[model samples]
Target: MIGLANGCSATWHANRIFFLTVAAYALAVVFAASHWDIPLNLRIYSRPFLLFGFGVTVILFVVIATRVMLERPARLFPTLGRRLRGYDVVNRLIVGVPVALTLPVFFSLFTSMKNGLSRIVPFYADTTIVALDRAIHGGQDAWRVLHPVLGAGPLTFALNFLYNVWFAVMFVVLFCVTFSTGDERLRSRYLVAFVLTCVLLGNAAATVFASVGPAFVMPFYGNDTFFPLMNYLQATNAVYPVWAVDTQRMLLAYAALDGPRPGSGISAFPSIHVAVAMLNAIYLWRFSSLLRWLSVAFLIAIELGSVHLAWHYAVDGYASMLATPVIWIFAGWLSGLRRWPVAATAVS
Candidate 1:
């Protein structure tokens, strides 16, 4: 451990808080699995490892292509060789492997935690949140309010497509941050903030609030409060692929299983999807004006998607957007990160 630590970057050391956080969360996951007799499968690691490998390949290809284009075409092989230097490769792997490995474990455990939530605390918050959603949206379900503009089948389908885009966008950010060679302090803070957002808003807060969103309430609790919205989504899906409909059905199936499954967790309140989008926007805001505005636009789409797609109430997005900045600030403080002025260009 000391030998490995000796060659680590300051940025790597700065991620100590994030490392410790995941370690602690892993412990909790283990305890929960043992107590519940849930199988902790090693195979769960394979998916993330494969994804990490693919991302690394893509990054390397992009770098090599850009360098060869800018410098000399003949240096392509040499560039690849130089880029694959054993020490640099090993060093980055040392720094990045754990970061890459965290997702599968984090998500698998998150699924377990969310699945176990209702067992520990019955979901009694949905009906109440339904009423609260109406009151806050001027006595109409938030989806109804959105129907005037977004009610069209093609638009609804487009929003659903963008909502699914969140996963890819999120992975890209994570991959960049893990492999980033610039601004270690900033990277550390963002990493810490990202983990905190998942644990706080996604896990702890979700379990406390414990409400299935509009899509699942009817299936889970026999409440048709959101049936009309679900019907509309289903109708749109029939014409164009509103993938959320199928994903929601899959979640319900996973929720029924006795053991934890990959990508099985589901919660409505304090939308993690929106919170993550907000975090990405805030972090990238300092990089460049283009990234700032693009991320901000994505954030808005995610909020609107959450409602129109029937995955969350308006208040879920509202609460998530509100709490994310607080978590980001707290994470910054925890990491002792200082504010840096915006940069005109992003680091390569």
Candidate 2:
């Protein structure tokens, strides 16, 4: 154990915090699985791992090829060789592959556990959450407010596309942060925040709230509270394209057929989509002003899209916006607690 700890301290350095966080998260996932009687299926992670690996590999290859072509045009092979030999390149591959694999593997298990446990929970809080949404929106359905300005048109289509892009955007950010050799502190902070947001807000909060959101409310409870909003989305789907409609249908189908599978889980009290986007925006705010603003805009679009697309109440997004920053700040504090002096000594 001492040797292993010393090795991790030396090899991972300050980034050990992320590894430790992942470890703790994995343990929690295991406990949840056992407690919830959810079966562990490693196969659930295969597709996601392959997709993430392929995307990261292609992006990295393009970046390196571009640099080699532009900077060392005359000696491309030599430049490429040198780049491959660099510590950053080697470390990124060595450290990144494991981190990337770890995320999906453990997260899949966690997600399965979350879905199964959600079913065991006594009640769905759709009515309470909907009431909260109404209070916040001044008794107006959020989609109604958005439908007027966004309308069923090109803008709505674009936003739907962007909303679906969240999956890719999230993976890209995780890839960048995990593979980053330049900024250890930043990387640690982001990873910690990401894990905490998913586990705390996505899993814990959702479990406690135990609500299915607007999309599933009618199907699950036969409540027409959000029927008009769903009708509006269905109408928009006729003219423009909304991916959420299809996704919600698929999710409901999966829920009915298989209960809860790897890539599919249903809980909507505080939208993880919105929380993650806001978390990304907060972290980006520390780096680039432009990227930060773009992230915020994307977050807003996600919030609006969640409502307009019938996936969530407006309050779901609002709660996420309120919850994620506290988690981010807490992650920052936790990352700061890494003892660099002890780590250096142990490594030496």
Best by TM-score: 2
* Full-model lDDT for every candidate: 0.80, 0.78
Model 1: lDDT of residue 181: 48
Q: Write the per-residue lDDT of candidate 1 for residues 132-222, one digit (tens) a residue.
A: 9899989999999989999998898889889999988998898778766467667778888898898888877887899889888888898
Per-model TM-score on C-alpha atoms: 0.88, 0.90
What ranges in model 2 sit over 4 Å off?
Answer: 1-10, 84-87, 345-348
lDDT of 2 by residue, 1-348 (tens): 987665454457746778898788878777877786666665577787788789778877888878878885677888788876773675676556667767777677667766665655744788888777778788877777777887666877888898889988998888888887777667888899898888888888888888887778888899887787677777778888877788889888877754457668788878999999998898788778899899989999998888877778888888899999898888888888875566555444
Top candidate when judged by lDDT against the true structure = 1
Q: RMSD for all candidates, in order, please.
A: 5.0, 2.9
Task: Write down the TM-score for model 1.
Answer: 0.88
- Deviation in Å, model 1, residue 178 alpha carbon: 1.0
Q: What lDDT does candidate 1 reach at residue 186? A: 78
- Model 2, global lDDT: 0.78
**Candidate 1 residue 330 C-alpha distance from true site, Å:** 1.1
